[model samples]
Target: MVTVAVTAVAAALVMTGCSGGPSSPATDNVAGTPSSGASSTSKSTPTPTPAVVDVTPADGATGVKPTAPVVVKVSSGSLSEVSVKDAQGKAVEGKLANGTWTSKARLAPSTAYTVSVTAAGSDGTPATTTSRFTTLKPAVTATYGILYAGQTVGVGMPASIQFDSAVTTPELRAQVEKLVTVTTSPKTEGHWGWLDNRQLMWRPKDYWQPGTKVTVNAPLTGVQTGDGKWIANDDSASFTVGSSMISTVDIKNHVMTVTRGGQVLRTIPISAGRPGPETETRSGTKVIIRKEGTVIMDSSTIGIKKGEPGYYKIKTQSAMRVTWTGEYLHSAPWSVGSQGSSNVSHGCVNMAPENAAWMYANSKAGDVVKFTGSSRVFQPSEGIGVWQYSYANWVKQSALA
Candidate 1:
């Protein structure tokens, strides 16, 4: 009995030894048995690596103007995600190109912006980075103004203002018009006429009151015109109108009377056309073309041959103003004795220099310069002075209403 007991104990010890300690499980049944949970747990599982991403326009950059384009780039695996935000953190609209993103429109000035991006690695791990930037401050400046002021009656004297820069906004027009103030003797009501985007004209529906005072104030110190340009600084000018100085020239009588406020200033002796080469001056209103201290009268320039019987040439002196083609109210010293007495000039209203000066001093741009006593009324042509047309007819010539 003692020997059998000992044998059983030895067998038990051997079985325990054959079971491969803790490392082996069901080793004897490896040919067909499934592995226990302990066996499967022995094999380790791998954890995926995280991905890294980078975005452009890094954090805290400033002095950025809206005119500049916003660009963003990503790194690491790829641009798996990207976004831009305003100061309020609202997502701004943008477009993605390749691994980069961009905004089509400019950003607002003096604003803060943020950019975020995410990139994933092959291991399915995502990394993100954010950047901040600020926009540039706004610029404030002023601009200059142009003035066209004169008082030639008959539509020739229009108050024109031309802006050096193009006005992109209509509001600018109103701002400019506010600077204009007209003080006419006969109180007139008128509005601005925009000739184009850059030019404006101010005129009454009719001619200005005979003796009106027109003033222009252009305070375009820092206004923005357009195309990144501002009005010029230190620009201003003014002009004045004299009393009502209206003149009437009768071609048949060959006389011109200067009047002021219904009072005749002078009755200058004059000579009118003999009517062969359309010497008749238009009978409508007229404006002075220009003033010259002296001018040389050449008949050839007016389609008159130098040696033609009707053509004559002479040097004129004290020529105050010439208002028509081949016509001048100049000092005819040679004919001074005959002036105011007989029609002896070649169609010019010959007058003393003093008389011409008086006319010049009293006349403003819009003052009526009327001519009568012509069989054929004055018709407007390109060569004729601007005043040769009726007020209604002159308005029709303007592109603007």
Candidate 2:
């Protein structure tokens, strides 16, 4: 009876422990199986972001200066390509380096431009961006002209560029100088100088070599001359340097000597300016600007009116202009007897009709005419008086100096 009672109590304890209740393996100690209450979740990696592109002169921006550079920047990847197009669908030149792109060519004023950029992400995914902007319209569009264009000139003739508006400051003038380019066939050495605010001229250290071919390019359409002023037109010219034709006029002795390539061509009787301030030919180097066939000489153009002391209007033949102030080497028939003797005319080199015709027929524009022995000096600001200044002094007039 005692053994049966003990076995019954042990059976009751085993049944209680095996019951699917609070003590059934504690719900986490299951064999060969993971528990739902414990953390056994697998982790997954996050996805990477794509590349980003940024453009300068932001999209739809207006009134942008042409000088402002177009820039493109990329992040999280490498730049694939960049394209900038104008309204005409012409591509703007640009360069890319170190993941950045910048415009290499100048933009036009009052024009619309479109920029398209494409880049690749680290995951080899390509992304694109675009921008549109318009350049500012200049208030005053300046104009310019290239001198001695399409002509054969003398060795002493300098390449001249004249602007309608004045370039006020030296800094502005330097900017204008940067737009000019000159080239020679034989590769001559030369430099540019400003005789005044409106005139920019290029001359060699010495006279140009005969038979040299010169070409000039001035892409000044986008150049700024002053505040609110921008050049709207580009200019270019090609000129040839002809044979060496230099003439010397001796006022004291009243004679004119012509030479061609260091050899004496002819010695002609000539009468130069008489003694006086208002009626004396300027003494210095002069470049023949143009040949006028039959010009009416009016003293009023030189500030001498009808009733003035030296006022006279006459028609001269075979006239070659040497100065802006009413001076020329022309045919003066009335003063033929005074030729090579006494200087008795206005500020002009009077020669016989035959002599004047011969000189005009043989000479071209840019021929050198040098006059000596006079009280009045030729100013650099006068007609193509570039030879008056030494090469060193002429260089000092440059904006860069």
Candidate 3:
């Protein structure tokens, strides 16, 4: 039995050596250590960079001011191109640097603007983005109609500005007042007056020198009016002063004298307003606003209705408008004989057709028209009557004063 047991133990040992007994579960490499075996599936694909872009105002925004700041940027990519345009398709000037874009181009008021951009990912994948917005159009806005280029005007042409909305606050008015400046080649002293909240006019203390160059700069973008309105954009004009053409109309003598550079050009017989409230011509320093070959004269337009005394409508030629209250230097053929002898008809400087034509052709807008010898005083609201106020008095009209 001992011999048999020994033989069996020897046999078991040989069998154990021939085949491994129980196999333990295959062990994984320690965490973060390299693995000997490779991945079973095909080599895994690498992750790609994300494509992204952004623009200010998002898209489809409204009530944007022309001066609103703009920005464009991209992430995980580089910006390739960007463009901005207006409703008229004019390009807004911009600059791109340091992976960003910016612009200072002035925009049209109450206009729509668009922006388009392109970008490239790290892997060269192209991506595109776009945005559109509209500029603010205030229900009330300011209008600048006095200053314009190329027209030779008189020294008395005030920078007449009117607003659809009233500006009553002093600070608000000051904000607008500073944005407007008049620079002359010779450099002249001037002052601005608020003719009420809605109108502001600038004029020199003395008449402008003949041949002076005046530049009117009105940068109103983002400027706030006193009453919930802001300036939409900017406007500028340059004008050259022509010869000094001034006319002195004497209501007593019933005569008109035109002068240039202190020399008399023409002295003609003229018929002024008859003695009355509605018929009296304003007697103060005034500027010739504009001229017309023929303007239909209407007394009712001046609040002198039909059946009222001295109410007659007549068509006249060679008309030069001097005041807003229906006063003009026009040709009156029917009153030619009485022109130099008497004050008759309505509130107009009536002269012979020949004289009227000569004056109209020679005179430029801004010419000085001084009406004296009458009790009538020009109101600041009546046409370009800025000369009605003295320099000191005019200074008092400014909010900044």
List lDDT for all candidates, in order. Answer: 0.57, 0.85, 0.79
- In terms of TM-score, which candidate is strongest? 2
Please tell me which model should have the higher lDDT, number 2 or number 3. 2
Ten consecutive residues with minimal summed lDDT in candidate 1?
1-10
TM-score computed on alpha carbons, candidate 2: 0.85
Pitting candidate 1 against candidate 2, the one with the higher lDDT is 2
lDDT of 2 at 362: 90
* By lDDT: ranked, best first: 2, 3, 1
- Candidate 1 total steric clashes: 26
- Tens-digit lDDT track for model 3 on 1-401? 00000011112221222224544345444678554433333344344565577777568889877557667777777888989888778787788889988876556568788888877766766667678988778766655444446688987787666776677688888977877887887878889888778778888889999988888777776676744466665778888888998899999999888999999989999999988887888799988988877999987887778998767789999999998788999999999879889998688999899999999899889999999999978898788767888899999998789
As a whole number from 0 to 100, the lDDT of residue 256 in candidate 3 is 86
Per-prediction TM-score, please?
0.46, 0.85, 0.69
Using TM-score as the measure, name the better of candidate 1 and candidate 3.
Answer: 3
Please give the distance, in angstroms, between residue 35's alpha carbon in candidate 2 and its true position after superposition.
16
lDDT at residue 382 of model 3 (Cα atoms):
81
